[model samples]
Target: MSTVEVILQSCLSKPAGNSLLVEQYVSDTASGRRYLLGRNEHAAEIMQMIEVDGIIDDFATNGTTWNNKPVLTTEQLPDQSMVVNCAMCIAPVSAARRLQKHGAIEILSLAELCSHLPQRFKLPWFVSQTRDEIRNHLSAWNSLSTALVDKQSQQTLNDLLHFRLSGDYHYMSGYSVRPEEQYFEPFIEPSAAHVFVDGGGYDGDTTEQFCHRYPGYRQVYLFEPTPTNLANARRRLKHQRNITFIAQGLSDQQGSLPFDTEAGSASAVDPQSSQQIQVTTLDQAVSEPISFIKMDLEGWELQALQGARIHIQDDRPSLAIAVYHQAADFRRIFDYVTGLYPDYQVYLRHYTEGWSETIMYFIPANIKQN
Candidate 1:
């Protein structure tokens, strides 16, 4: 059987009682010390679910405390202590190795500890919705595997699928850590006359990188909706020349929508949010020819792309769009962009070791493809 079919079969079967094993471990180690390997937003929630002796953070100094529990460096952790990793942003395998080197007898990721818990803790790109979407769009998923431009991208898709399906970090062991080079692929030659657009510009980090990489770029149009984030972006890019900051979110249509600002980087268009923010379509926002466009909107990429149909059809701007927001995006975004301009070469690159930061690059046929 093909790898995809084998994965489908495994997913179709009932998942093993891994949560039960976690429960048994916790019960057996009640008298022993239990430490959380890393600290993140979910650390407190994990503590609430299970008993934790202390928190271990590599960056924390002496006498620091998180959730009233002492925070110790990995070197300070007692030998043979059981640890549950709470750092969702880092690679699980790397985190496990670090703890093991520091004398952790057993380790469990936050995902494993709360795998059977409420859905909110499941994290992005691997939620139940993603699994359902994959099951429903198996044909699209299969097509995506073969549609990728290079062998590495296909392997990335395969590894990510296995990791998502099994919740096993072992599949990510081969992924290289290269978030600093995201959105700017080596194959994409930097030009002096590049007109860049930074959609969902948060703190002007990506724009800053663009300025450094393309020093003589013509202009930059950064679109950010959140007032605080927009202010920060403006402050960060104040010295940069030929830059315009648009304090509005990108979407299919122009209007105001409820937004949630509490989630920080994950803040997005949440209908349940009481706060509202203005949004506009890319077609209506920019009329000039754009050479490159990078979008990392939380989950509003498709709608924004729909709004930029005219620019995409006319200018054929190089695109670095985040497809990791939703599972169907692995196929849906590829379909939408290819449908708009069939000649565009498609490529996929993942920044993080985990499921986040998967960008789908759409380079116009006019650009050199390596």
Candidate 2:
């Protein structure tokens, strides 16, 4: 297990009376970068996972703190201060309760540092082109989005419109999943035996929902590399008879790979990154009837899918993939899937309003012949 994993296991193994929730994020500044730690009941868990004083002291020693930027550390955080972002939303305070009360953060530009936060997350992103830049990008995206939108496209638009208006139909409430059956149901019905390969299964929520709804499935296999996520997935599915959880990650090759980030967040084995883990391909590791596959790998969707080419061609399972990670991923994944199985009907939908896009795939009732 990785260092983070060990700490997470220790956290989860604690007594039931203990309730803790800790979150970490990156705080970038002109001088340097520092880690932001947030805690509720589980402040101790955060302490166990990180070198608290060390990390804080590093930033302090570098003189990165006490900046004009709006970030709240353990010492510097204000009780009710606001943090602004220049990219997605305006007045994006580091609190969700505030976000729910207020909708849409104002978009600011790098040049408008005086107007908004001085810097935006300068990471490689799919929708990096600001809202102002969308018009220029639309022309390039036209062909790709057009191709991805199938017959259900119109209905999806209608549903999305309704959802935006009233947060119904397309949205889910709590643990209860709203059943509109947009496009993923067709492929799941007829399979005599089914196996679901959940690549980025977090806390096993999706897998639990799948098993709860479809209890007769052969097995649900989960590949979560992070020790925290993997342990939680195991704990969640411990009572289930038809589930197998693995600590290894699914990648294009077989070897130890860095996860690149903290546990339970975005993980990768791209060699160039920091945190990594052992990798294995689906074809080499799996030996069952994989009827459905769901991938939410931060940006490694293509690599993970490519590793499952044999399964994609042979099983042709329904896919729930996050296509908003990379700009070309929408087109790239569509082309890759359709190129192998031309008859498979593709249906796309963006589940959340912001963040990223969740695209779904539905195979035709039967294989189409040329």
Measured with C-alpha atoms, the lDDT of residue 290 in candidate 2 is: 77
Report the error of model 2 at residue 127, Å: 4.0
lDDT of all predictions: 0.78, 0.50
Per-residue lDDT for 1-370 in model 1, tens only? 5566677677445343367756655676465568887776667766766667898888888899988899988778777777776654447677767787865467776556545553535443364656787778877777777677888777877777766665556667887667679899875657523889999898899999999988979899999998888899999999999999999999999999899976767889998899999999999999888888899989889999999999998888889999987777878899999999988878888877677888999888765321
lDDT of 2 by residue, 1-370 (tens): 4322332333223321101111112122231322332221122232333332212111243345322322333344333222222122111122222323333222111122211221432211222332223234435334444554465653453333222222111121111222233224544453522787888876787788777667777887888888887888889888887788877777777887766646345555456667667778887889865777878787787888888889888877777776756545655777777777776666766544333445656554474311
Q: How accurate locally is residue 226 in candidate 2, as Cα lDDT from 0 to 100?
A: 81
- Model 1 stretches with alpha carbons more than 4 Å out: 10-24, 38-50, 60-71, 109-127, 191-193, 367-370
Once model 2 is optimally superposed onto the true structure by TM-score, how far is the C-alpha of residue 136 displaced, in angstroms? 11
Task: List the pairs of residues colliding in candidate 1.
Answer: none
When superposed on Cα atoms, how far off is each prediction in RMSD? 3.6, 14.3
True-structure lDDT of candidate 2: 0.50
